[model samples]
Target: MLQTEFPFTLPCGYVDARGNLHRQGTMRLATALDEIEPLQDARVRANEAYLTILVLSRVVTRLGDLHPVDVRVIEGLFSADLAYLQRLYVQINEVGTTLFETQCPRCGLRFSLDLTEGGDINDASAGL
Candidate 1:
């Protein structure tokens, strides 16, 4: 079965009006409508960058104690958290998996690296 939702922890997290920090969240795979509807949103029409906010709001089903996360919540997120989610969105939707296959040149050993842990292919020391 295809995985439709992915869980994540924000690096900086969202701080609610009550001053509570929400770090954990779940983002479901976006539907065609999820991508299309946002394009028609006035906010996105005004500022193309706002598309990220709308798209994220629709796909994120839960966040910490919050359910049905919305644009207001996504807008309140720290920049780091927004960036984190954007990368995650691309990783899961575009790349299709967090596990990256790589090989050790010397030993010819193959291994899978978890991209969610901030792994970088350019950083040779990664996963060592």
Candidate 2:
């Protein structure tokens, strides 16, 4: 979360019997909601990318966004919440079509998962 509050102080131009200007500091609070436009835009873009993947995978054909089929596809793979899925989508977009290396826990063979637009499986022997 981001803090959006700031404070300011100003001296009063009027003087008392002592001929001294009075100074006071004022406190105010501003919510980040007013500055969330860019974050909201980014979230919308992430959702769009997730929906595109759903469409490509035939999870939904006609809807502008995810449908029951898409939900089913997601549920089939991971039982995660919408926020988690959105974050995952954003991370995947950031990774952007590269071969990421990982070792198989079961066989101890090093493999690479291509983070491409379409999932591509490469053999561990490829050494990519």
Candidate 3:
């Protein structure tokens, strides 16, 4: 089955107006509509940047103590944090569950790694 939920930490983090820092969160995999629906928003048409804001808002289920993640939270993210989310979105939606697989040259044992949680084998912690 396709893994649906993904966890991540922001590079710079999002600081709310209350001064609370939101660094960790869970982002669910985007469906076709999750990506396509934003293109129809007037704000997205007016300012292309809002497309990502909307898309991220829809996929991010939680961030730190914040409940019911919203567009306001996405709009408040730092540029670095935004970039991290964008990368993660692509990684989850495009690259997918199996990041890579190989067989040990010496032992000849095959193994595969699933990155749907937070990261791939390249950087299991994927602090990016």
Global lDDT of model 3: 0.77
User: Mind giving the per-residue lDDT tens digits that candidate 3 earns over 1-128?
Assistant: 86688766676777888888987788998888998999999999999988999999999999999977999888888888898788778777885335533334577444445545764455334432
Rank by TM-score (best first): 1, 3, 2
Best by TM-score: 1
Q: Write the per-residue lDDT of candidate 1 for residues 15-126, one digit (tens) a residue.
A: 9999999987898988889899989988888999999999999999999999999899999999998997887777668854665344555775545466665764543245
TM-score of 2: 0.24
Q: What is candidate 2's lDDT per residue for 1-128, written digit by digit as tens?
A: 52222111121222334554422211122123423433445544677444433422231221222232243443333223233333323333332436544455577565557756697878757754
Q: What lDDT score goes with residue 83 in model 3?
A: 86
Each prediction's Cα lDDT score? Answer: 0.81, 0.36, 0.77
Winner on TM-score (1 vs 3) = 1
**Worst 10 contiguous positions by lDDT, candidate 2:** 3-12
* Candidate 3 wrongly placed segments (more than 4 Å): 95-97, 100-120, 123-128
Task: State the displacement of the C-alpha of residue 88, model 1, in Å, after optimal TM-score superposition.
Answer: 0.5
After TM-score superposition, what is the CA distance of residue 120 in candidate 2 from its true location, in Å? 1.1
Q: What is the lDDT of candidate 2?
A: 0.36
- Candidate 2, residue 47: the lDDT equals 71
